[model samples]
Each structure stands twice: as C-alpha cells, then as structure tokens.
Target: MRSKIEQIRMSKKNTADSGIDIIESPEALASQISRAEIFFIKYKKALIGVAIAIVAIVLAFAAYRFYIDSQESTAQSALSNVVYAMENDSLSQALNGSGGNEGLLAIADNYPGTDASNLAHLYAGIALIKQGKFDDAIDHLKSFSSSDLLVQGRAYALTGDAYMEKNQPEEAISYYKKAADYKSNEFFTPVYLMKLGIAQEKAKQPKDAIASYGKIIEEYPLSAEVTNAKKYKGLLEGEVGE
Candidate 1:
C-alpha cells in the first residue's frame, strides 16, 4: 500500500509519461519563454499606466489632506480672535466684520465647511442675541451644530432666549425644554430647568411650568433655582385651585 504522498507522486509521473512533449528541446523551451516575455512587453504600458494611476490616487489623497489641514488652521486662527472678542464682551467686534481679521460672522460665512466656522456660527448667534438682533440670532443659532454636551445645551438655551426676545413664547419654551433635557448634568440642568419653567409660564402652560419647577425642586435642591422653583410651584398650585 502506497502512502498518500507517494501515490500523488506516482500519479503525477504516470500523467507526465502519458503526455506528448510539445516543446522537448532547449531551443523550443527558450522560444516559449521568449513568447511569454513578448506578451508581458506588449502589455508593459498598461501595467505602467495602472502603477501611475495608483501613484496619482495616493498623491491626490495627500494633497486633499494638506488642503483640509490648511483650511482648518486658517479657520482656527480666525476663530481664536473672534472667541477672544466674545470673551471680552466686545459684541460688535465678535459678530461684525473686524476689519482685516474677520470676526465670527465672517468666518462662519466664508468657511462654512470647517469646524471652527460651525462654532463661530454658535458664538455669532449668541453675540447677535446680546446685541438685540433676535431674528439674526435665530438664523445663526439654527445653522450651528455641535457634539459637545455643554455647547449644544448652551445653543439650545440661547435659542430659547432669542425666541423669548422675539415674543415667541411657545418656541422659547420648546427650546428651553430641549436645553433642560439634552445631556442633563448637575451644572446646567438646574439653570435650564429654571429657564424652561419661566418660558412655560410665559407660554401660558401653567401645568407644564409647574412640572418644570417641581423637577428643579426635586432634582436640584441645592441649586439657586430651587427656592424660586418652590415659590413658583406654590403659585402655580394656587392658580390651578382657582
């Protein structure tokens, strides 16, 4: 009984013996090798074209990354100045065009695709609201987006303020509620709840307002809003009874 490996070897030997040698001589083998070489040489340009295409794709990607980095850096530099002005409460310098430097508004306008520009939209909206441009503030704030919990919460709160300023109590209450609920934290939650309660009250939803105030009283007893929440709760209960 032959081993498996020996059987495979003997089978291959028998197959080879049964086959006719088409290219028996060294010269014929050389000719066959030369034909293979000719075929490769004929398609050499196509292979080189593929290689060039690959190289071009890599270079194009590198160039795209470089462009993106440059744009981001430029946006960051411009945004930093706007943020400084905003921090200093220089609302005009922060929102309007600041001569050659470009304020938050301009950066948000000119570089719509960048992260810095997106943040600029948010800051610009806040500045517009502070400057009493409620309509413009709403436009900018609506365009702004952020993944950060605090920033998103602040934007929602600011939107509520803008709506409140525009005499849109219903919209204000909705935004205030959103701010209070989004990523609720001990720091901003109580403040947002207070704003929500106030907005709800202004919107003539006394029951909802009472609920918001009760939430503050129950969840954030140590908050400054807690005293006001309890007082408002009592007032709302009295109103309901009458």
Candidate 2:
C-alpha cells in the first residue's frame, strides 16, 4: 500500500511538470463549462458594446477616406479642364477663367488640401511671372509644394528669378542655393549653380560666386553651363586677385 501510494504521487508530480492537465471526472468538466457560461453572462452587455464600437470606428474611417478620394477626383477633373489655357499662353484667362471653365487660381482656391490645388499654385505662379507680377508670382510659388526633386528645384530657381527681377540679390542667392543643392543633378544643377553664382556676384560675394561656378566646371563638365561657369569663375578670380 505504501509503495502504491508513492507511485501515485510520483505520477501526479510528472503530469504537473509536463503541464498535462487531466480532468478527473465529468462533473469537474461540467462545472468548468458552467463557470465559463456564468462569466459570459456577467459581461455580455459590455462585450457587445465593445464589438459594436470597433465596427463603428472602422466604418467611420472608411467613409471619411471615400469622401476625401471623391473630393480629390473632382478637383483633378477641374484642373484638367482648365490647364489648356495655360498651355496656350493665355495668362489672364488661365488665372481668371474664360467662359464657364474655371481657371488655375479658382481651382487653387476652391480645392484646398488637394494635389490638384497644389499644382494650380505652380501654374498660377508661372503665369503671374510671365505677366510681370513678380510679387504675386513669389506668393503663389511659395504656396506650391512638391515631392519631386526636379520640379521643386525648378520652382526654387523660378522664385530666385523673381527676386532677381526685383533686384533683391540676397533673396535670390538664398533660393538659388536651395535650387542648386536640392537633389543636385548634372543637367539642372549646373543651371541653378550658374544662377547662384550670378546672384552671389551681384551681392558682392566674389569668393562665394567663384566657388559656385567652380562646382559646375568640376562636377558637371558636360553641362551647357560649363562654358559660362568657366568664364564667370575666371573673371571673379581675377577680380578677387586684384
């Protein structure tokens, strides 16, 4: 009897160590099921409310996304209709609309928070520049934003041009530097660097202007700006030496 009792204890110990739970009787199993049912009954209302809340939140987010997508689509369509005026060089019509078609300025104003609205700002700024509205061009260009490095750089360069036209060499230098350094490439960077060098020269920063031109000669030798860069750099270096 003593040996049998020891063996039973040892079996229980091994089962516990192995994490193998054994239900001793049907009554115990039934009791556990009953307790689980009781737990469900006690929290049924709260559990249902939580599930409903999760579903409502998901639906609300989906509806909001759909609304935003619809608004963007409408704005893009409006932009497509009006961009022909810009292409045709009808500056006034492009900014103020012709007939029933909306203009770039109108699209920009009406479709706030849309990609098309941002592009409208760019178009309007360019039109303003062509019309000799330098201050207005700067304002619209400042409002325009882009993720594309090339386009954004071009906008910066254009802003520099506006400032230069206004005889603000310091402001022109700042924007030209941004255009030159923004994801610099051989093709466009040389152009921007040339602009920067000119602005720096006008600002009486001969050394800085020479360095800007030197970058074009050394880094973008194949660019069209290379010839001009060399000429400018030589002139500035001679001036500094004198």
lDDT scores in order: 0.87, 0.90
Q: Count clashing pairs, candidate 2.
A: 0
TM-score for each predicted model, relative to the true structure: 0.73, 0.77
lDDT tens digits, residues 1-242, model 2? 56988999998898785443336556657778899899989999999999999999999999978876887898898888778888899889989887888888888888787889899999988999999999999999999988796999999999999999999999999999999989998779999999999999999999999999999999999999999999989988898893
Per-residue error (Å), model 2, residue 171: 1.8
- Span of 10 residues, lowest total lDDT, candidate 1: 17-26
Model 2: lDDT to the true structure: 0.90
> Candidate 1 at 172: error in angstroms?
1.0
lDDT of 1 by residue, 1-242 (tens): 98999999998987785443435666657777899899989999998999999999999999988887788899999988777788899999887747688888888988767888898889889888888999999999989888797999899999999998888989998888888888998899999999888888888899998999999989988888899899999999999993
Clashing pairs in 2: none
